[model samples]
Target: MKKWLKYSLISLVILLLIGTSWFTYTFFIKEYETADENVDNIVDTDFEVELPDTLEGDLLDKNESTDKNVNQSKNESTKNQNSQGNNKETSTRNKEQRDTENDNSKSTNSKTQTKDNNKETKNQTSNKNELTKENDNDDQTVNNSPDESTNSEEESEKTQQDHVTAEDIKNRYRPTFQALQDQALAKLNNLVAYAYSEYKKKKENGEKVSYGYFYKKYKSAAKELEAKTDATFERLYTSLQQDLVENGYSKDEASDVKAYYNQKKDERESRMLSKVLDKF
Candidate 1:
């Protein structure tokens, strides 16, 4: 019985030890496999997060390049518009300058034509006056001629009288005529001097001067001188005619003397006017 009991106990102890060993081995193997699986999942999640970030960075760089290209294109377009505007402005200015020059040229041409017309008119007027004076002289000679028989003796006397000449007539009238001419010229000179002085004063002050003002002043002076000279000649003629009548000359002889004096006076006036014109 003792031997059977001991044997049973030993068997029981062996069974218990075997069971403990199997449990420990199975737990250790399961824990190792679970830890390896967890490590693999962590590595795959890290790789997924990193790949998205890199893709986002590449997209941002592409957008930036597109924006830069768009900005460059806009700048080029603006520069082209400015260049066209400058060209148009330059063309417009040139056209305006050309038009101004053309207008000035036309104005100059018109002024030249007007001056030529004025000169031609003056020449025609002078010719007409000469023709009129010649006609008057011919009429006077015709009216003065006497009958043929008396004309021969009268002609010889007339030849002797005419031989007294323009020089003799000029000598007789020169002193009185020169005095009147000198007076007129002195007045004219004074007027011209005054006008010029006034014009210069106004010009210095930056004022405009009109040609009409100068012309009117000159006309007034000329008219006053003409009136005074006409009155003097009339008085002289009346006095001389009265003297001839008082001396008991025949009507015809007194008339002839009066006519010769009148002719001399006209010639003297012409010479004086010539001198005045020369001074002008």
Candidate 2:
């Protein structure tokens, strides 16, 4: 080969090498710069959203506030329920107390009424017992015949049927010891009345009869009765009061004697229960 030809070939090769290097540099430079710009844009816009952090924080605060308001409303409702329950309990207790007081008052009244009824029944029973004892005290006839001793049971039965309570202490009277005592007392009391009546009569007739003069005559008559009787007038009068009904004195005769000694008192109370009774 010629020397010049070899040199030319070498130059051509060198030129080819330079051209290829230029094309690759032009294309690759543009691609590298575009990648760099894309990297910058990703860095600027990465991890960013449409909604701001400030706005998200406001939404979270609003949600928390709403939850707090609901909780407060629930607490207020619970408090109202508790208050209503307490009020109902208080009302029930008050009603029960009133009922208890009423029951106690009714019980007290009932006990008082029961006691009164028992006392009345006891008084009636005592009066009946007294009458029975008086009837069993003696055997007597409705006649003043003390010397005639009759042993006939039939006659005694007939006499008991017509015994005592006879009017006017004359000869025909109950031949009991009580009746005889009452008869003697009646005679003395009648004599005392007659003595006073005679004094009044003398005073009305303008006689010189003072209280001393009347009392002297009354004592003289009392002395005569004392000498004729086995017992003194004072002793007999005391015995008559203590042993009137118990010594076979009739109720009518005893009542007459009592009328002379005492005044009638009030009537007895009733034993009926109360009209209004508790139903509960």
- Candidate 2, number of clashes: 0
- Per residue, candidate 1 scores C-alpha lDDT tens digits across 27-74 of 432232122232223222211111012223543565565556555655
Candidate 1 lDDT: 0.50
RMSD (CA, Å), each prediction: 66.9, 72.1
Off by over 4 Å in 1: 1-174, 249-280
Off by over 4 Å in 2: 1-8, 17-51, 55-59, 93-97, 100-104, 107-280
Residue 104 displacement in candidate 1 (angstroms): 99
Whole-model lDDT values for every prediction:
0.50, 0.44
For model 2, state the Cα shift of residue 134 in Å: 70
